[model samples]
Target chain A: MSSSEMTSPEETPLLEVRELSISFGGLQALNQVSFAVEEGEIFGLIGPNGAGKTTLFNCVSGLIQATSGVIHYEGQPLDGLPIHARSLVGIARTFQNLNLFHGLTVLENLMVPVEVRQRRGFIADAFRATRSRFGESQAREEAGAILHLLHLGDLRDVMAGELPVGLQRRVELGRAVAQRPRLLLLDEPASGLDGRETAELGALLPRIARQLSVTIVLVDHDMALVMRVCDRICALDFGQVIAMGTPAEVRNDPTVMSAYLGASGAVQVAQR
Target chain B: MRFDRQLLVRAAMVIGAFDVLYLLADHVGANYRRLMTLSAVDGLLVLSLVVLTGFVGQISFVQAELNGFGGLLAGAMIGRLHWSFWVALPLAVVASVAVGIVVGVPALRLRGLILGVVTIALALAFDAWVFSLDTFKAQFIDRPSLLGWDLSDDRATFAFCLAVLAGCAWMVANLQRSKTGRMLASIRDAEVAARTSGVDVTRAKLLAFGISAGLAGLAGVLLDLTIGTADKQSFTLLISLNIAAVVILMGPNRVASAFAGGIFLRWGSEILDKVGVGGKYLNVVLGVGLIVQLIAAPEGVVGQFSHIRAAAGRSLRRRVAAT
Candidate 1:
């Protein structure tokens, strides 16, 4: 896994979001939000409620099409690709609420993406035919590698729903990574976790980015996680880019402070 | 490829058990033998529901519609087109896939009870229009004596139907363990989540629907071959509802439960008829049994057995460890 893509940021950014905007009915959910994520970087999107952070993730992942503007992945336009097509093209995402299959074990959950990555037709797979069985051993090897990578080796055969929420979140992350995505979109992965779990997640993001050689764009409300892990952070407010820079620079910006802690209670944010 | 040893063993067991039962059936009458054949046909129908509602979680009340279409088409090919039954078999399955796709298209947009209601409507339309067509009906239905075996005899018909049902059952069992099986299971658990995981939800659901319908079609073709008729009236919405009830009673994931429900109900009805109760009144038995199953064991008889088997395996492992 190479981190060399981070050094050549001058080349076409791994993901370039240009003036993306969308509206649900009359309310403009996102308005001209723009940012570029270089490869092997843990980029964070932080904002208060209704700030269009999730909307932006949805647009980039192709869950919903943007009303205007464009998203370029590895210098290629992702305009016409469907949701699963985007995943096939090395884009993967997790939901705000965890979406792991309750019936399947953690190993099988990871195998879903491994099977998807193999791109074998279901008809052949139904009969256990040539092309389907060809990658069976390799897929298991890859799934084992991922289970180890995600620290889920212990819970390999445990049903995904039986695991703790923190572990389920980890399994969901492992599942997305199993797709071999170049750009991983994580939506509010820390919503239900306690301090310890969130800290562990904060620790995992950078390791995932560096080790897997994937660019990360996470939408989160946890400021400590945002400030601690992200190489650079983008702040959104009322569907627009409010701040875009290093964590220190963005933290010091007055507009971001007022947007989060309000103008009067600004200094209290440092304690939070 | 290595065959699943357990499945092969189970298939042999089912066949051996039925042969033993055939000895007792001979003392009773030819009616018992005929019911044995019906049991296998019913198993195919129940397996159809297993795929549609069980794996895909798509509620389809139009399974009988698809089944009737396949049966009649196969019959027509054998009778009207003067084609061999073996040749018409694949054509029937292909035609059922087309019908399944049509029924499944609405499923891409609809769900649950609404989908069921839509299928019910489609079922009536099919009986009144599609199945009523001269093209789908054949007056000259004949037994498929493909390998020079007379399939018309009671024992032979039961054996042949049982073999066909077992073959389909084996194929379906293999499917549920493969990647496509996981794909369908994932869709059942979480459709949106599956899409984000790079599973084309539409394709997975439709594929399930197609395979399920094909099974139903295959069963229907076998039914026409056995009984020498493919009357559309026999495939009413009532039969589909009965199948749905059995699907709920037997548990979805357990493939054997489909056959179990079929054989139990077929014999149950036969016994009921001999004991001065109308066999049609078994719907009362089904309803009561369903109520009991829902309250005591929602996973149904098969799921209950699965739990017991797992527990027994664990205890056996512990015993070996102690030694």
Candidate 2:
């Protein structure tokens, strides 16, 4: 048995990806990439555009099937599971492009995951029975709490699509958090945010990881936010992991520096 | 709960308006009363489209086909099997729902124009083969006798159909506020996002189709009873396209829109007839109306009205504050 397989239940990683690989028609998107996210840690995946960061996130969340790999969540194999099934098993994700439901209100957007996690049946919903009523009320309350946590309580009734892009990203974060998942995958949560908003998010991510006790795998191109927020960082270049270590170690790595800045340039790391 | 008062007022207004219409139909001639009844049945059919197309963002041209299936089944159960209306009604709805699930299973792999084509194919098949079956060719379908009072009376049947429409509207309104409804909207907005959030997109899609089919089935039975005949010609593919046009023209988000679409579907032709306009002219009007609405108000007539109302309210509040 592998060392990872021999880990006890209590010490098992929250998420383990082994030799994951996926290729498009003629181009390889990800190649034999592997990583393990510990519980309650803010892990970061940093790469330039087309480095397959989003693709890796998609594979972990089961939105895209890996060409070859084994993903174990909490020591159980997650092979062949559908996206919703993975979500039900406590895997929640936010899109790189904000995917908030445009037709629904902000509060209703947050309630989507809560509703999915609840136990209301179709018959109950059709009849407007007690179970359905109670479940909806509970979902609303939970969503309200999440909105408050994200400091978006005032915009609860606003249409999601009508919100600013920065606010939309926060709403998407709230939606993923509302799932109450053990593992959360956020794709480019700071992509479109201004510096102030990105800084706020940088502080918020670690606090969320600590307070909620949830593991987070964040993929973002924002170097400063990733360096400040993430405990460990994985830098990928052309679908290959170039560095995986503490944020400082990744920042100092020659390959990561060369990948970010061209080979001729001297590495000068910026301090946040 | 902030909108509770508004909701109550809207509900009261709707009920009062329908009550006034009921009284007006009572005083009017039988032809007018029959028109109103048919309009209510059409309202239910449009509501099915509202749920499927408006809320779930799925375009289906098979609603009329599902309606035909229900009408045929209800006719068989009542005319041949000697079943009561209550028994036959539920059976017909359930059967249509089953067929909806069957169609929805294959439809899961299809979306947008392809799905529309598949539904159109289903509609054509029903029109060509299913309706031509000897068993579905019932001369007359008997109406139910409720509480020893024959519902064959025009006024009573009108009231009954009105009540059914009201009940369906209320249920759909309630559904829009429910969790399932939110999930459906999410699926419509972003299927991948909804799936990542743990929503069973396939199940939600199937449920949307099922509810739509069941509602269509109810509308079919009511239409058959109102006309006092089971004519297959009444549910042609052209009728399906016409209903789609009406729903799109009038909007499908609100039950009021569906109700309005039904009225327009029935009375628009009547008005054209009264004006000595040919039936083909009515098609031109519908086609033009659909194109105009799509370009100017894609949210539909009722949705645009609400937007205007909200804007007006905001301006009024601003003026009051300024004063």
Candidate 3:
């Protein structure tokens, strides 16, 4: 179902998850997770390892189905949709592990999502695709624009696999943005970057959010970057939300502090 | 959609280059000319494999058999039913495409050795099925006249087949530059990522299969046209294996590379004979070559050429900068 057919855009958040829970075999991964992201907000999801942060992102993106609960995008339920289908509903995601199409050129990597979104059909692609017929495809122009936005115009012809990790991360982000998603889910955008690269990414993320007018839900281990840029932050521990509020509130919350530092020893650290 | 001047110039250049080659083809002896014709036809079959195996990362050993369907069906239509060549051509293509899609259904769920086995089974079935049809037995077929010109002459038929191969090459190259081109390339690398990127993985695979099969079918029809018969021996599982080997050996990267591979596979033995080293030892040498190819150049010979060219270009650029 389309967002236009939804009940009301104003009434519903861009993304809403209610009591989301999942498990692999018997191990409880996510339990009663709930949150709502407002339109055009830079939302951060932070948790320690095994806290089901990636699992939660997977559930929302349609790679992993939650055992129970609902995921709504612009008031439309996205729980039953496939991963690719979620992209059509304006939800695009970057992987915690970079999944760029390495065989393709940098420009072609960005063009892939744009082409997939805009392609008519196989027959059209073979005989009448505007690019083949006219020599300059709209996909190229769109991809070129993304390269410019990502400041990757110089490396457009380079193979994606040959690029540096920081540049590759940026290319992956560029690819996700090329989908023109309204609700972008970034799984550790700062994962493999150096301090300088992380700082550059931190600066770029908010610009992407404001310029594209997109609602972003970024999950990362980098606490400083999340704290600096996020409008709101949600902390998860053992698949349960310990705190959800403005970045200051979540960071200062005692439960979040205890969850990260351990309840018994954390108080002692504070005492000292 | 403005008409591009560079595109037109490129098109002219491609055609001009082919015509020059075609003129040289007119001078070769009948045997070599005929062998090259078969090579071009084989190249078409190899081209199909490139799309499936190289681009989509699917294996098929039935490409030659698919070509046989075009050859034998069109052959039977013209030879037994007395239908016109032009009329049977399109019907044969569609029928082979249908067969391709049917074969592709199993491929959707199967991959690697299982997929390879499935294709081998299909190829064997095709051989047996064609052998059972009495009317489909080896029969003389005539090439049709195009635009009031008779194609009964060997050189004329060879020229026509080359033209078709060139067209197919152009189409394949064009498809690569299209949106679907990137989709297949993505499918080749990370299929799951392609799916999440909004690529309908199933449809894309089938499209690759169908298109590849269609090209093979066309090549099969051309094979019959060039040889003057719908020979059952041409579409055997052995032929399919050879075509598969050719694609792998050539490293299915470029249309030019595939065409060159086809020439090598089809006429390599003949060329070897001309050089006075043709016998049982040839197969041994080929086995060694294949082993070397796998280890030394997984991308195929064309891949090596491109690598060398790239290295040369880098050095040249460096020298230019120094100057």
Best by TM-score: 2
Worst lDDT 10-window in candidate 3 chain A? A1-10
Per-residue error (Å), model 3, residue B269: 0.8
Q: Where does candidate 1 stray beyond 4 Å?
A: A1-10, A262-268, B1-28, B137-140, B274-277, B316-323
**lDDT tens digits, residues B1-323, model 1?**
24678868877898787777667556657877788788888899899888777777889888877888888888888888889888998999998988898789999988988988999999889878987788876455777675888876767777788877877777787678778777788888888778888898888888888888998898888888778776676677888888888888888777888798788667877777889997878989889989999999888888888899999999999999999
Displacement of residue A150 (Cα, Å) in model 1 is 1.5
- Cα-based lDDT at residue A231, candidate 2: 81
Per-model TM-score on C-alpha atoms: 0.93, 0.94, 0.90
Please give me the DockQ of candidate 2 compared with the native complex: 0.73
Ranked by lDDT, top first: 2, 1, 3
Each candidate's DockQ score against the native complex? 0.65, 0.73, 0.51
Better of 1 and 2 by TM-score: 2
Q: After superposition, which runs of candidate 2 have C-alpha atoms over 4 Å from their true positions?
A: A1-10, A263-272, B1-15, B311-323
In Å, residue B312's CA in model 2 sits off its true spot by: 4.5
Q: List the TM values for chain B, per candidate.
A: 0.90, 0.93, 0.94
DockQ winner, 1 or 2: 2
For model 3, state the Cα shift of residue A135 in Å: 8.8
* Candidate 2 per-residue C-alpha lDDT over B143-233 given as tens digits, one digit per residue, 9 for 90 to 100: 7777987889888888888889888887887787788788888988988899988998899999989989999989889987898877787
Choose 2 or 3, whichever is better by lDDT: 2
iRMS for all predictions? 1.3, 1.2, 1.8
